[model samples]
Target: MPTVPPTPSPEVITYTVRAGDALAKIAAQFGTTVEEIVEANEIEDANRIEVGQVLVIPQGAEIPILCPILWPLTMAPTRC
Candidate 1:
């Protein structure tokens, strides 16, 4: 039998919490959701993030593209 390589892992984005950083702001900045951040980090409190704390932000879905594939009939979403 031949040895096969492992599958590729999903891209991970890490963010360090700042003094004025909030989950909602962070989520909006990263195009993700606060719920996702909480879930990913298993956060007990949404407003308990500390300064310099690193967080794993999950970004899986591709941004919608808004390029027109066909006129009138179809509209392709453009990546933001």
Candidate 2:
């Protein structure tokens, strides 16, 4: 049986930079890593964010919730 993969969530949030804000600090506050934020916003310098700069905070990749009733018996169980 062929199994269909789950689609990624499109949810994202925006954050405004405040005084003394850093990539690391902002990442920590949002429960995400600095690298993820940088990749999402295409930031050239992780240390160069300015006050009032709007940042796209990519929430952690969500684990797809599987419903057994929706899946076929021949399909393997999802790791999630």
Candidate 3:
């Protein structure tokens, strides 16, 4: 049988926690699932996240961050 490769999923966005904000509210505001937020942040306890804690918001689709180092992928490879 021929082997099949798995598809890569989109990356999550990171958000710095703010005072008086809860995970539930953040998840709702981002239109994503809470479980996703928990998993992305690697929270041992979902309720334990605190202010200044960084959380990753798994976006439905990924938008790449612009940087000069990433330019090579768009150009043709030079002969070695």
Candidate 4:
């Protein structure tokens, strides 16, 4: 049997860039990171985003926040 790669989850969100918008701010609003956005969009320059540019925000890509109380219970970390 031929093996097939699993499709990525359709959890991406589209965001249009507005005037004075920066990757850092967008990432914060979407609970993601600038690095993830840059990687997802193949951005050549982090400092050079234009207005009205469409960006794909990958959901659940941010590093999870580890809870001290739950640290010993499971390997999975909870969202911050």
All candidates: TM-score: 0.62, 0.61, 0.57, 0.61
For residues 8-35, what per-residue lDDT tens digits would candidate 1 score against the true structure?
9877778899999999988877788899
Tens-place lDDT per residue, model 2, 10-77, is 77788899998999988877778899999999999998999999999886634334445645555666
Provide the lowest-lDDT 10-residue window in model 1: 61-70
lDDT of 3 by residue, 1-80 (tens): 99989989766567788988888888877777779888877778878778998877886824334445543465665432
Stretches of candidate 3 off by over 4 Å are 1-12, 61-80
| Per-residue lDDT of 38 in model 3 | 85
Ranking by lDDT: 4, 1, 2, 3
- Taken over the whole model, the C-alpha lDDT of each candidate is 0.82, 0.82, 0.74, 0.84
In candidate 3, position 9 carries an lDDT of 70
Model 1 CA deviation exceeding 4 Å by range = 1-8, 61-80
State candidate 3's TM-score.
Answer: 0.57
Better of 2 and 4 by TM-score: 4
Candidate 2 TM-score versus the reference: 0.61
